[model samples]
Target: MVDADQTFVIVGGGLAGAKAAETLRAEGFTGRVILICDERDHPYERPPLSKGYLLGKEERDSVFVHEPAWYTQAEIELHLGQVVVSIDRYAKSVRLGDGTLIEYDKLLLATGAEPRRLDVPGTDLAGVHHLRRLAHAERLRGVLTSLGRDNGHLVIAGAGWIGLEVAAAAREYGAEVTVVEPLPTPLHSVLGPELGQLFADLHREHGVRFHFGRKLTEILGQDGVVLAARTDDGEEHPAHAVLAAIGAAPRTALAEAAGLTIADRAHGAGIAVDASLRTSDPDIHAAGDVASTLHPLLGFPIRVEHWANALNGGPAAARAMLGQEVTYDRVPYFFSDQYDMGMEYSGWAPPGTYDEVVIRGDVGKRQFIAFWLAEGRVLAGMNVNVWDVTEPIQKLIRSRAQVGPEALSDPSVPLESLAG
Candidate 1:
């Protein structure tokens, strides 16, 4: 057992930081574990914010990870509304916003990513928001609720997960939603045009207006409130509010300032971590969106800003920090809830590797599984409303299972039966 005086300081109070502290207690670490977060709100599940919370289907407290009493019982110190400005490596301490020096035996940096800004004009308008923190979601939810009085239009910039989800959520609330994407298809960079087309159709069925191959040139505002937006295609989208869900950049400034090594991800920005989830400084560990951890399937570091990644990554990194030798390398997984569809995707597939996708059911009926294969090997599987295949698909990815198209397309063939 670690001495009660020994401190493990964690930065950022998102899913990652909370999970790490929870895991520490679970693993018999009775020493001091302090979670310092900049956000004053309690740690909550982020997935719900894009779906249920935005649509008023879930209350704010429903998404909370741990109650206040649980943290107290677990002996985890909560430092709410604390911003870590820098780290003093030589002093083995962190400098906070209020000039408090927090010394640590080991530091776990869960300083999650920040929303990427839209470089266009009028981005600072009152009704223009970015979906990253809980405050933003609540503020937008309130704005969406008040839309009954206004023209009730929401212009979402970028067609990424956040944009698509909020667009779907707003449409659910009977608000006019428009999505602007520079790519020919939203999520084209990852899911390809065919799958992306499915999402476009799905949203269109929900009455969402989409502008593909268009960029936001400017956001027009009246009295510092977003009223309209202009696209690169020379079109204007009427809006009561605009959400810039373009993307996110890792919050590595403090870690880098402390002389910690950082690396650029292939598709995003963040400090690079090894397979063990340790940064350049052995004593300092990182996870969540801020730390680009190694993915076994991709054979390189990936920064996945998702609830599952953070929840799982936090514990894995914490165990490694305790010299437990825990490996976080699992088949990459992500889940999304759009409309009534319950979706889960796994595996690493390079672009152009999947020319054919074998579907087990119908897309319109909202019951099916799509398998992305490269040649004869299973590259990835996307379960749409059907979750029965998740277990086998996960095993397949781990073993790099090679199955024929006939087996994949046949619903009668049990996925587990093909397990090697």
Candidate 2:
């Protein structure tokens, strides 16, 4: 029942959109595939922007989802550097910035999120930066190197993953780094106070200064060049460069204009999609950071902005668009690399969701698996400097079986056996 004449339009050129196009072809969809991307560069993964690429460990080509010729060979009409200005759900078409109208039988919105801007004054200064795009990373890489050579100071506004990773990179480059976070500890929301302190300690040991319980109130600069950053506590930090690693907001203007249902702030505040990744309009689907999916297993609507979501969500959405039975309930997963330590966290356990945190292995050595439990049932797990345990950790979460905290903390206990 495949229709060769049918055209599927994908709006967004990030990993999700690119993977969706790849999935369409892999799934034997002979229909016309059109991918519209605002960025001139070919679709690429975003993680390297803050990780390997920023640290100069990865080449520019490594970030791209595919070779430039792959789209041509796959028969995917890739319109790069073209912006989709509007989505006309009624006409089943999208209007580009150049005023080109392209009709579609089904549409996918993979538009990712944009970095949240610092509303404080002097953010427009030359040394103030945000790390959301490849261009930003490219610029930041040189800036960090220059800062390091001159022993210039870097003031980071948040202690989130991006903030910490960039701090690590800056320290590795031999630059002075000071992170300002409003919360009591780094990654306060995700890891909570318990494990959040661990990251704070790790960064501190790497010579990164932390200004906890404070917020960057303003960036002080002269002649449009960042000189220093002022915290809410009235502490002034000399800053040759300032990085706003606060957070990102989903790009949902087109979806909202097209009358698609958007989730509320409490539910991630993104384009609302069912478990199938289908939006309010049956012909339209949303994925990646822009899609707030009502998860079946978690029993809540969640929008994840991690790299893993885009890596998997796009293909899932493509299969759903192909009229295949689909349910996107993959456990939320993310990882971070700082200094000499690398860690992977699986599942969702925001502050109140878990009653206790159990640790296996040694915390002092930074080699351990931390588990969040609620009523003796595993809610989430994080492995620090531990390898080959993500499978069992995910299984434990999926199993939803009650487990003893003592057994969870014991290194002798095999995680696979307890997963049941």
Candidate 2 lDDT tens digits, 1-420: 335699999999999999999999999999999999999999999989888999999999999999999999999999999999998888899999999999999999999999999999899899999998889999999999999999999999999999999999999999999999999999998999999999988988989999998889999999998999999988899999999999999999999999999999988999999999999999999999999999998999999999999999999999999999999999999998998899999999989899999999999999999999999999999999999999999999999999999999999989999977
Clashing pairs in 1: none
Compose the digit string of candidate 1's lDDT tens values, residues 1-420. Answer: 347687899998999989999998888887889899898887777888788888888888888899878988887889899899989888889988999998998899998988989999998889899988888888988888777345499999999889999988887777899999988887887688867888998899889999999899999988898789999978899988999999888999998888887876674567778888888888899999898877766677778877778989999988987889767786778888888777898876645867677788788787888888876778788899887677888887676667888988889998886657
RMSD of each: 1.7, 1.3
Candidate 2 regions off by >4 Å? Answer: 1-4
lDDT to native, each model = 0.85, 0.95
Taking all chains together, the TM-score of candidate 1 against the true structure is 0.96
